[model samples]
Target chain A: MDILPQLILNSIIAGAIYTMIALGFNLIYGTVKFFDLGYGALTAVGGYSVFYFYKTLGINIYASIILGAIIAGIIGFIVYKLVYTPLRTRKSSGMVMLVASLGVLTAAQAIIAIIFTSQFQTLSINAGTERVFTIFGGVITQTQLITLVLGLGIMIVMALVFKFSLFGKAIKAIGDDEEVSKIVGINTNKIIGWVFFIGSAIGGLAGILIGFDTGIEPTMGLSLLLKGVIASIIGGIGNVYGGVLGAFLLAFIENFGIWKISGEWKDAIAFGVLILFLLFRPQGILRR
Target chain B: MTKTAKGILWVIALVIVVLIIVNVSSKGGKNSNTASSTPIKIGFTGPLTGDVANIGQNAKAAVEIAVGEINSAGGINGRQIEMVYEDDRCAGPEGVKAANKLINVDNVTAILGSVCSPATLSFAPIAEKAQTPVLSYCSTAPKISESGDYIFRDVPSDLFQAGFAAKYTYNTLGKRKVAIINVNNDWGLGLKKAFSDAFKALGGQVVLEDGDDPTSKDLRTQMAKVKSSGADLLYFAGFPDGTVAGLKEAKTLKLTQTIFGADAWDDNKIWDSLGSSADGVMYTRVGTNSSDAFKTKMKEKLGNDSIVYCSNYAYDGLKILADAIKTAGTDRTAVKNALYSIKHVNGVSSSLIEFDANGDPKEANYVIDIIKNGKAEIVK
Candidate 1:
């Protein structure tokens, strides 16, 4: 009975982490309508930035975090301009775009590995193990709590902006029909560039928080992206609310699934759920 | 055929022919007869590139130093040694290619190398078939024991380290119940199985056992089960990245059980990443008896970041091969026989270096070390 609460807590924490990733993934997919695989490697960019600034250079941690996100955003924007924008101009197929994004992903991951040496690095100066809380008999660390709050907080903020803002309408118009969006003087490329910056910033922030919680590694991007992609697919690839729901659902199922079976099967269980969603409910919980 | 395609094929053919000719002439220029002033060809294969290249590079440095020392000390029975280096790049296919070249091309009498276990395992069969003896310096996998009669490793196997860990956790630490979580990879499964089997043999109860993906950073699912396991000790068999995550999550869950690790936990980066949360965590690793003299010599040769734990064994491995060659001459079978006959010899790695029937080092000392304030201290 006591274990149940902790299992739920663990699921919530895991879900929150995935939600950070899925939120950014959905935000980008919603706008561009192409799976931006390079979005994954941007997480490492954020983490390494913080590692260099806060850990190595002895900068203020908060300031370092802001710089990390901004740098990731700028990098994301540059990648879009350099690689993705040309593809968009050519009106390339989604397959071509996906492959291009994969190139971006591979190059970015390699660059980060070259800079950081592919070893696991910790960004948390304070290990954060000391500051722990037990809520409803479920233990949660300060970093984890921050992760949960920020996940939901960012989701709500993005939801409101999408519902009421001009930029949000522009994004939806481009997503619905890029040709129509461009014809309406929406500046599809510029809007998509900003979308890339915003989405990648969120991804970067997820990386920073994850670094504080569990440390960072260059190759972590792929797995992080994988979980988020699964969540986005299950919730509805382009729907933000669907991504959140799918993330929590996936997390809950994964945590509870492994509770009965051995822990070795956790990833197996996750992939199994992904397969189930793909087969039975391909459109996910909400149809875009 | 297309003109461009015909030209490309011709170019490839020419390159292959040129490579073979160059290879033959190089060896012919170096050595003609089996004796006299000809250098004894010894082949070395290891991941001289890629992520774990540092380990291979350290081994290379140690081998180079050994080669220098042996030559300076009037050579191995007056025949100077020449090392043919091949960069395996830590891949299995690469290892096989390197092994083939070392055997068929360079015609090395003995092979010393291949730091990674996969590479060693991959090339062992080819070397065994070719009657070329291989001595691994850094591969600690128990799987290598069955690799071939011609294959031998100076490093103690993970099975030995795991048994030591299990015994230490059960008898020395006086822990009865243990919860083990390991990576699903070969290294993890091999060590984990060895541990559970040994622990069970000792009448210790394993309350929970699970394997995790090597790349996974989140272990809360496993940790949740472990929290309720009521085990006195938690055993982790993993590399550094996973260890950092496991320790941090374990700390967050606030589990009161003592965390124990296998040989993999000897990494300094794990402790650095975990910080104070790593305090009280203990691990059993194959202890080395690297002398101040050896350390000083290594520093003078290659500077800092050169003295990896594996380098100690690498130094000993090269010396063992050289000693075997000196006794039995350059005959591969004689060298193999010499290795089996060779008994206790004190070297940089440990107090004793003796090969058993399986070509594994007979004497292995496991040191129990504990983390305190984010740093490791030998507790035993």
Candidate 2:
């Protein structure tokens, strides 16, 4: 049976989630020039917030998702103020900021563990009523199609905003040279704060989408962050369009690479591609 | 040096001081002990921090409850069993240090724990050389027993649990084609191998095999492949973190199938992370909600507010060890012999617990659990 079409569809969906994380990570990394390890924690925040509101508090899932994204935006602003801003003022090295981010990751993970108590949970929306359709010898779920559409829509909107909006131009100017942008009266700090809020909202949306698609756990952020980082690095660090391209490329390679081997070798193939990129074009595909 | 570095150095110094005091006091106490009156001290080690800490803390609580119960029932041959707990940080080197401290400094007669198989493997040789009996409740690696007679595991190895889950996936869930995703670790590898063997033996077709580092973030690549594999089911083997994340991504990508796993998928942490996406996650684990003994004992032990599965197993493990000691009449050798001789002993989770020559429990049932509303309920 030819499952190529189904596989392509699935890869596109997976690529969408990766693009969400990559977009946020790339935005932050490009402008700040420091790894925001805490972005992963925000993903957890987004997932758990929706989980708590919908599953625990009995709120509607759609409402919970909006509430979760808003909360993540708030958290992103606070994290920028508390951690990144102070580090920036200190003229901290990238390594120092990286370490601080790791600390935030550890502390955030510990807090999650303390609150949720480390059990696997599921959203109960389609507990037993999922419908699957077979096309071209492969099966696809309705929920997956929705996620793919949502992801593509969000990416398109983000790309449009980046190309057209005044806020997006300010963000780009800040990324190019924070001092120069500040000299030009850009209010770089406030613009950066807004960037975090918007970027984290995207991350939260990714988290919510992931929750609907898979499941949520306290430690889910780490793997999500790794994928985002890989996607960003592969496509072009700090390049908005690059993340989407990178995610799709990564998905296609991984999906098709395991045709002759056990699927277990899929990751090795992905990492091998990553290594090749690292060795040949350390600047990444788009070379921002 | 930087302020943070200076602070870290001070903390390290303080920890060293505390360790020195503990070591010196333990040495003095051992010397002061009258040869005939020395209590049989036992050391228990595992993570007391981080995500899996709940597993260790519950195990520790169970040990405490069981120790108190056995001591009240009159010590193993009138010799009080004393437990000394340590945090292994779930790492190999820390686990070895914990074992050394227990053996050389505390002079514990036997040691329990060092949860998570990697840590357990590190402490195995140290315990064996010290001639201390080490019974692990958390380590599930099949090779843990190969460290020799000194090592005993209360929980059935992943071999049995993973195989059973794979069989259930094929015969019960009706999954013909499956994809295997495992973490890069002993626990993950062992379970994957076991599942592969059992699934193939049952005539199930495995379409793909994928490995992910438990700590990595981007799983979309591997997940996308699984989605496109045309498989009927997905099997993830790892701690709850990776399993939950992978499952959630699979859901996002619209990869629909029955997801199966081993005991690591049993934690509530997975639910906290996965949220709504966690529904329908299937895994095999020691039954958490089946037997009356576990429920009743847990209620009596932790009250209704804190009943956990690991605690019940730990409590049962302690009871079993104490029973063997009592049945053997005070000698450690006799206790070991009696443990082997026993054909059937009721456990907190089982109606009958019997060990074979390899010390593997016979008729051991790994209950299949389906996640419902963030909790795992026994399905098969």
Candidate 3:
């Protein structure tokens, strides 16, 4: 019953979740070069969509997850087309885009609150019969285990795509320089649109998993987004592999920091690390 | 100018001037001397829209039922009781505004409401300044005991609950080392302090203590610390959302210590979602022994079988206010005096309530309940 094993297990579970969010956020930030606050709302949208399909409409849970991810992807695409794309055409500043994204986040959260009545909802259908597995003196539920596996699988696939896929090359070109990518016949708009969909779909998967692991709330998105943003920044923003590394590091730091202190200091410890990084190593642990 | 035309215009203007003066005077007179048979206005403030809206709305429904029963029986002193409800949204600023509106605009003699402790604390000063008696049905922060002489609540503060829980854990359950994890809020902090004080007084050691933001969903880090503390029991103080998440995480970590909680865990929604995971968890709640007749009435009214404990307190709060008005008339000061001295008031919580020097219930019967098969059963 060494507590170290349990603490490590908890850190890994949290790190897995943060990795999913940070990867998607880093991918989008690399190309867009702007903070999409609306990304948080999409997390809620993904969870609620599955809740509607599986719980309300009686669809199969696995199928509902696919549909929910697709719906989130489409919504992300629509937001780009309607808001960001138009703003880009108008030559708006990044600040303007950030503000617009905030507006979208607020409106989306309000809509979800109205529809879901601001009540905490669990997405599990078999919460009562769910089984627990012990590993190295630490316990984990099935959903958490799946979360770890999903995080690893996604990271491997993303790394391979970045290395080999033509679509990935197009994305990198655009991220390097959008104007030059267009002149080089990279079809920047189409490639960026695809990036948004894929990134948002990954974010949606994270949301769905979170809903199963804990529960869903309208305001859950903002906190999740904050953690992801922190991970991306500390991991070297826009660096895909670095984002994953930063996520696990943050998870470990936060969990261990509270090992001998009050849990109320958890958030303070996170921001303290962020501030330290900004002050001493502005380039983060892994500089691009 | 023609003489007849000027004369007619002057007469019409005079008539209009006289009508305005009469109307203004009558409006002022009506407010000063409200008719005896007119409805006695009572203002209610609670969260009808935000996070804790469920509790607020439930309390409102129960109070309305009590109002209906009172009015049908020809209300106190042959006057009907009318309730004006304001949505505080469970925030401090919102509660302040609601209290002002209820006092200044609505001109109510008494106010019932504000389920959340922060909201109640925010509005208590305003009610005291206005000399309006405010009875909170659910707010249980220990600070409320000394908030104001005019501020009252039917529900006992967390002091009683914490003391009960501490004794139960130390004596009945025979757990010596205890760890505490609480949400950082008025309710949580109050219980945390009270329980810690009581536990230490009973010669039990507090091994570790921590606080979490109410909005935080993850408690694994805190659970890890709790597990390592070598504590035989864990006392978690939080509302339903945080509690459910914390419990799930503890179960995942296989923290086998007994978990103790406050009344916030009385929520059925949490138990239903938790399923078998909630089994064997114990919590202390104000014993609500509502009659079958009341349950049937609440079911027919709310379209549900379950009525939260706060709703019963709210129902009793209205009855107590009416009884006070009957005994001391509608004058705010007289009603306050009567409330301060009110004795042996029968409430649905299976307790006879009498205000102490500080306006809290002098004594409350706290019952320990254990969850079994997704239902909370009172431990005998």
TM-score of each: 0.90, 0.78, 0.90
Q: Which ten residues in a row have the lowest lDDT in candidate 2 chain A?
A: A120-129
| Candidate 1: residue A196 lDDT (0-100) | 94
Candidate order by decreasing DockQ: 1, 3, 2
For all predictions, the C-alpha RMSD in Å is: 3.4, 5.5, 6.6
TM-score of 3: 0.90
- Better model by DockQ: candidate 1 vs candidate 3: 1
Candidate 2 lDDT, tens digit per residue, A1-288?
A: 345665676567667778888887887887778889888988888888988999889998779989999998899889889998999999999899999999887788778767876544555464324566666655556656666677667778877877899887888889899999999999989988988898888788777777766666677788788778888889988888787788878877876776555555666877888889889988788877
Locate the minimum summed-lDDT window of 10 residues in model 3 chain A.
A125-134
- The parts of candidate 2 lying over 4 Å away from their true place are A124-147, B1-40, B45-62, B84-107, B114-119, B138-140, B154-188, B191-294, B302-313, B323-380
Cα deviation at B376, candidate 3, in Å, is 0.9
**Winning candidate number (DockQ):** 1
Error of 2 at B298 (Å): 1.5
**DockQ each:** 0.48, 0.22, 0.45
Query: B1-380 in candidate 1: lDDT tens per residue?
Result: 99999999999999999989997777654344276678888999987765456667777888888889999999888888889899896668899999999988788988997877778989999999988889998777788898888899888998898899888888988999999898876677888889999999999999999878767878887887888888998998876677788888888888889998876666666776677777898888778888887888788877774366778888888888888988898889999999888764678888888888888988887788899998888894
Query: What DockQ number belongs to candidate 1?
Result: 0.48
Backbone Cα, N, C clashes tallied per candidate:
0, 42, 0
